[model samples]
Target: MIGFVVEAECMFYQDKPIHFECTACGKCCTGNAETHYIALTPTEAAKLRKHLEVSEAWFRRRYVEHLTRDSWGIRMHNGQCAFLDKHGRCGIYALRPTQCRTYPFWPELMDDEAHWQAEKKYCEGINRGQVVDIKVIERKLKQQAAAEEHA
Candidate 1:
């Protein structure tokens, strides 16, 4: 009896330099309904509230979904963020959350090449722009981890 072993080329690795630039497609704002929810830190919520000139109660009612006693997320409108405008732009772009600012670089997506490839299907910006600096990726990853820890 003969057995065969197959070797497949690995297309992505953590050390491999990658390129990503937001196309402003707004795909990242929409996610699986059941598991997709943006975690907001207190500072983020406050920043958004201030930007919109809305009170906490008013903001919560119009744009927030309470996830837990200590946590909440931006409300989803038809599978997309309520703040996502008709032009596929963030309505509150200047004040978007840490999650949005550090997108595509999320831990789950960067943990493996397969995860990154799966995300590429949703994000046209992946592999379309300048090669992302390894330092930037590390910094962004650390920032995300800190945000999670604080939240």
Candidate 2:
């Protein structure tokens, strides 16, 4: 019997894919030493409301902060997401914001190697899993962003 070593190819915005399973590292929630925005959709908002057993308006009031007149994202407390629990898990994982669900797969954001590298610096799990199909990623990104727009 012989053992073989396989090297993964580096691919971004192409067939070279990456997958990630959350290690509960909480680095992604901490916003990379700066404030980053995580936008939500109405569907996500409703789901979070159900999870938290609160009204949608109340959930938004407590956990979300509008960044500008036309943009919004989650609010952070002491560098971590306001909704991040002490155990380093999302309190509303089932209904987490679209932004949270789309880690390492933001189409608009990861247009080039530099952008991908920037994301990798913050998310330790970025290149750790099985290769993800690029088309699947693009579809998810489109669905999430469109859903947000409609919401």
Candidate 3:
């Protein structure tokens, strides 16, 4: 099988740089194509509950889908997230789940080469973007994961 390889430079904190300009194509939002929902931390779940102004039980019943072990992936109905708006923008953009906020840059899930290739095939943004420093991306992903854990 032909695999996809990601190439980028390494840099320190001050010099690390990366940029992505979303075209608003909504390709990432289409179906469950390129996205895999990350399990929400307890704090994250509580925050989302408050942000959506719903009870924690209701939020869990409606929006949270159980994955392996104690993990959960956000549930989607009819090919879109429950929180995805008509304009292709996240309804809870400001307080969206950590998984939604970290797109094209998943930390714990990107280690599999086969999965990465599958993602590259489905996401147009991945192939067209300018070169980014991998070390920078790694750092940002780590930070995001840490924030989610603490949220």
TM-scores, one per candidate: 0.87, 0.73, 0.63
Tens digit of per-residue lDDT, candidate 3, span 23-118: 656556557623555456666778888878998789999988777566766677677777777887777767765655666665433554445446
Q: Best candidate per TM-score, number?
A: 1
Winning model by lDDT: 1
lDDT of 3 at 35: 55
**Alpha carbon deviation, residue 139, candidate 2 (Å):** 2.1
Residue range 47-142, candidate 1, lDDT tens digits: 989989989899989998988889888988788898999987899988888888888877667777879888888899998899998778766766
In the range 70-119, model 2's lDDT, one tens digit per residue, is 55567788878887899877876777777777776665444556776667
User: Which should have the higher TM-score, number 1 or number 3?
Assistant: 1
Would you list the rank order by lDDT, best first? Answer: 1, 2, 3
Overall local distance difference test of candidate 1: 0.79
lDDT of candidate 3 at residue 34, scale 0 to 100: 38
Q: Give, for candidate 3, the lowest lDDT window spanning 10 residues.
A: 1-10
lDDT-wise, the better of 1 and 2 is 1
Query: Ten consecutive residues with minimal summed lDDT in candidate 2?
Result: 1-10
- Residue 124 lDDT in model 3? 60
| TM-score ranking of the models | 1, 2, 3
